[model samples]
Target: MRKSDYRKLGGIVILLVLWWLLAYALNRHFLFPSPFAVGKVMLCQLQNTAFYQAIIMTLSRCVIGFVISYGTALVLALVTGHMKWLRDYLAPLITLLKSVPNISFILLILIWFNREISVMIIVFFVLFPSFYSSFTNGFDAIDQSLREVMILYPQSLWRQIVKVELPLLKPYLAASYESGIGLAFKVGVMAEILGQVPDGIGKKLQWSYLNIEMAEVFAWTIWLIILLVLLEHGLRLLWKKRKE
Candidate 1:
């Protein structure tokens, strides 16, 4: 392994040791579970089919919400990038969406929709503004020279977008997706917990918390961290391949 990898592994080892020490000092299983206890719970959970099902369900919702939000942002950014008046008109709406507390959206959505739909909608609302901003910034960042060259060459609009805009937007798009996916997952889970969705990781987490199953709660959290790390690693691979 590389030196950096070894350093990171060492850091993780130190962190685990510190956590174990803290848990031992506290001597309260309800409040703090040792890494070994959480690992045992995680092993048990891994044997349960429901754990996989809950992960799949939550992931499906998160992906669907992210796709919709991303697609909408891409289309709107393309339009509003050229239309100053439309951009101005939508500014307040974007600002409102960005500024509103996530809990308010969750509460309102819970009232208006079923638990599953509410979770998806909350993910959408929470992520859309940030995605939209990333895309708009990409559009704005296109070089003036490139704009003039495009005008002089007079390519078809679709061709121009494919050949010019998307290439310029690649970095911004990548940045948004990398950051936004994790945020979407977290927001989706939070919504699920608040909405009390019948089946999800959030539901399981809520149940564990209510029952004061600290080990189970820690296990679930460790699972989430593992999932997120895997997701980010996969995305990084995809992005690296795309760049190549």
Candidate 2:
């Protein structure tokens, strides 16, 4: 392993040891289960059909929301990147989206949409503004002379988008994907919890919490961390392969 990887592994080992020590001191499994207990529960959960279903459902919703959000952000960035007035008009709405409490939005959204779709909507809208602005900034940062030259080219718009904008926008998109996926996933789960969407990890968490299944809660939380880490690593690997 590389030096940095080893250092990170050592840090994780220290954190786990501390957690085990704290749980030992507490001597109350109901309040705070030990890491060992959580691991055992997680292993058992792996055998359960419902657990698999919940994870799949949650992942599917997150993927749908993420793709939709990216598409909408791309379109908006293209438009607002070129138009100052449009950017001015949308600034307040983006600010409000960033500022308003998520729960407030979820509650209102539930009144309009079903619980299942509400989670997707919440994830999209919550993450849209951040990514839109980022993409717009990337677009705005291009060399003005290069942009004018590209505009003057007689080639098709789609060709220009594929050959020019995408190449330039790649770095910003990669940065956003690397950084935003975890936040979007976590927020998506929270939305599911608030919306009480059935057959989802968030709903399972809610059920566990109400039943005071602290070990299960810890197990699910651990699973979430593992899932996020795996996804981030997988994306990085795929990105590397694509670049090659």
Candidate 3:
């Protein structure tokens, strides 16, 4: 196997061993469940249709929110990246969003909207700045010489963006998405928890922890990690294909 495969296997083994040791030392399945116990719960959860629905629901919310953020950020970046004065207009708002606490956004939005809408709004707000900064940075890094060359071609600014600038930013956007997906997934789940939205991983986590079902909680966490890893791999594959 490759070095990366060996590394992954070694990490899993070490973590499992540590978990087992911790559980044994604690000697209480309720507080600190063993890996095996969590695995059992995970297996049971896998057999439940509700678990699948929860995963699907959470995934849908995450994707939808990220898509909205991504599209809006790209538009803003395209506009502000070339216009210095406009950056002044948006900078304070973006700074505020970036600086403010996530819980504050969740709480305030929850007051204005229902739980489901609040969760979606929270996800969008949490992720927008990161993606916006990534997009703007990508645009800022475009070569000035290339812009001058495009100027010689007699193409309009719109044509140059479509033909040249956007193409250059493809890799940057792909890299952002490849990493941003995980961040977005985590934040979306947090939103779900704060919003008290049902049929999501966060909701299941809340229920499990409140009922003192540590094993089930850990099982749900493991499932989330598995899902995130799968998504990261999928994004990697997609990025690779786009590069080729």
Assess every candidate by TM-score: 0.97, 0.92, 0.94
> Which has the higher TM-score value, candidate number 1 or candidate number 2?
1
> What is the C-alpha lDDT profile of model 1 across 134-180, one tens digit per residue?
99999999999989998888989889888889988999988998898
Per-model CA lDDT versus the true structure: 0.91, 0.86, 0.87
RMSD of every candidate to native, in Å, equals 1.1, 1.8, 1.5
Q: What range of 10 consecutive residues in model 1 has the weakest lDDT sum?
A: 114-123
Q: Give the distance in Å from residue 161's predicted Cα in candidate 3 to where it truly belongs.
A: 2.1
Compute the lDDT of residue 236 as modeled in candidate 1.
87
Model 1, stretches more than 4 Å misplaced? none
- lDDT per residue, candidate 3, 1-244, as tens digits? 9999999999999989999999999999889999999888988887899999999999998988888988898888998877989988998999999998878887888889888767777778988998898898899889889878776877887987788888989977887787778888888888788778999999999998789998998898888899988988887887778779
Provide the global lDDT of candidate 1 against the true structure.
0.91
Query: What's the number of clashes in each of the models?
Result: 0, 0, 0
Candidate 1, position 109, lDDT: 93
Rank order (by lDDT, best first): 1, 3, 2
**Superposed Cα deviation of residue 107, candidate 1 (Å):** 0.6
For candidate 2, lDDT tens digit of each residue in 1-244? 9999999999999988999999999999898998899989999999999999999999998878888998889888877765789989999988888788867776887779988888888778877888888898898888899888977875686687678777788888888877778877888888888888899889988999999999998898888889888988998898889899
